[model samples]
Target: MAQEVFWRRKTLREMNREEWESLCDGCALCCLHKVEDEDTQEVFYTTVVCHLLDMNSCQCTEYERRCQLVPSCIRLEPEDVETFDWLPITCSYRLIHEGKDLPEWHPLLTGERSSVQQANASVLSVYEVRDNEISEDQLIDFILDED
Candidate 1:
């Protein structure tokens, strides 16, 4: 008998809540703010981080009440995977949705929680500004090329 690798065997929509939550690599790129071009719909990543994001831990400071605290915050559901294009390319949800495997540095693969950071896939360095400190007009100044 062998243990089943749940992620490879199941679709995102087929997973239970625990399985779904476990998919997060915790790189926290999703917590960064983005700017979208109205005409082209091009989404640009920015250096600004959500107010609820803890700079040290890279976890939300108010995970449960995030929706209430920030209405624009996207609550990524399994069904929303395909539509959430703003998700970083390194994100587990986006990778799985695109029929790709998780990267070597993903915590699940490396068995080390800090692997994502070690791989330089996290937002720690880029996320120098907080969302509350910047205006929409200033977002362009912080646009960053995907790492």
Candidate 2:
């Protein structure tokens, strides 16, 4: 019999550093800017992404210092998993936290880091511009249509 995969067997809090890091699919949807509805507390994703993200690779150029450079950049941690609803439905961390399996295109599942990009599930397909290219007030105009 085959052993259970680490993600299925381990809780977010139980995984070690390397195992935790490997769970990322690298879609970069988290790098995009988001807006919240003041009344309903609903979050909306925007087409404007962080300028520090290298679009082609869908990786942050300054991974270590991202939160310092961009005040809004979120640093995902196991402790924050409960509040991960704002993350995309396909997000690996959110999926695991919610007791869901990684999507077929997830790097961990496919053993190919480019699967997310190849499947067009990456920010490269949705981003219209970098955050620095637009004014803060213009974020509403960049909200992605709820599909």
Candidate 3:
């Protein structure tokens, strides 16, 4: 029998749990808080990270309890790809959803976790503060140009 190539092409839903988790580029942009202008419904990104996010790891400190602790936290699903506006432009899930190939910096592509950080895709050294510590007015200043 011929061996199946993993990355030939796979949709979000078609991926198994390990493959699904591997899709995260570890950019940590999704963990940041965002503001939306109700009138225009335009989402604006901020540097304020979720309280649960570990700045060093660029991942939630408490992943399983995120929804319980942060009621507003969004649980991304394959179906929500097109609808969720908060996802970063560089997110692997979003990229796959839009029919784009993963960037070269992605760990899956490079086979190295540090590759994302090296490419500046991971939030390493760039987060500002927990959402609870920052005021809405301060958000404007924390907006990062990293992307």
Candidate 4:
């Protein structure tokens, strides 16, 4: 019998490290800075990104040392998915955790790595501001609508 596709067959918690890593579509929206309301608890996305994120490739420049280099950087794990309200709706991990299918343009589905970019899901062309340059007072200036 043919082997089942890993994503459809295994829950995020059930997937091994390699399987889990392959599920990432590499949009890099997670690397962007966000602001949360103190009382309202609303999360806002911003164009400013982590210094470690490569604007051209939209990948972390230092994947393995991210935690050490940026103490506040969140390394998302299976258990953390459900509670991460800031995850983009197009994120493969968030979609899987919410029992939704990957979008047709997902690399795993289309077998084309550029599909996500072609579909306009990747944030490659978004503003290239860095987190280190932005102050708390200026966060609202970079706030972007989720769409």
Give per-residue CA lDDT, model 2, range 78-145, as digits (tens): 99888999998888999999999988998888889998999999999899999889999999999998
Q: Over 4 Å off in model 1, which ranges?
A: 1-4
lDDT of each: 0.85, 0.92, 0.76, 0.83
Candidate 1 per-residue lDDT, tens place, 11-127, comes to 899999998998999888988888889999989888888888887787888999998998878888988867956788878998888888889898888899888888878888678
Model 3 regions more than 4 Å off: 1-8, 144-147
The CA lDDT at 12 in model 3 is 81
lDDT of 3 at 84: 49
The predicted structure with the larger TM-score, 2 or 3, is 2
**Candidate 1: Cα lDDT at 19:** 89
Q: Clash pairs of candidate 3?
A: none
Per-candidate TM vs. native? 0.92, 0.97, 0.84, 0.89
Please say which candidate is ahead in lDDT: 2 or 3: 2
The CA lDDT at 29 in model 4 is 77
Least accurate stretch of 10 residues (summed lDDT) in model 1? 78-87
User: How well is each residue in 62-83 modelled by candidate 4, as lDDT tens digits?
Assistant: 9999999988788989888778
Clashes in each model (backbone N, CA, C under 3 Å)? Answer: 0, 0, 0, 0
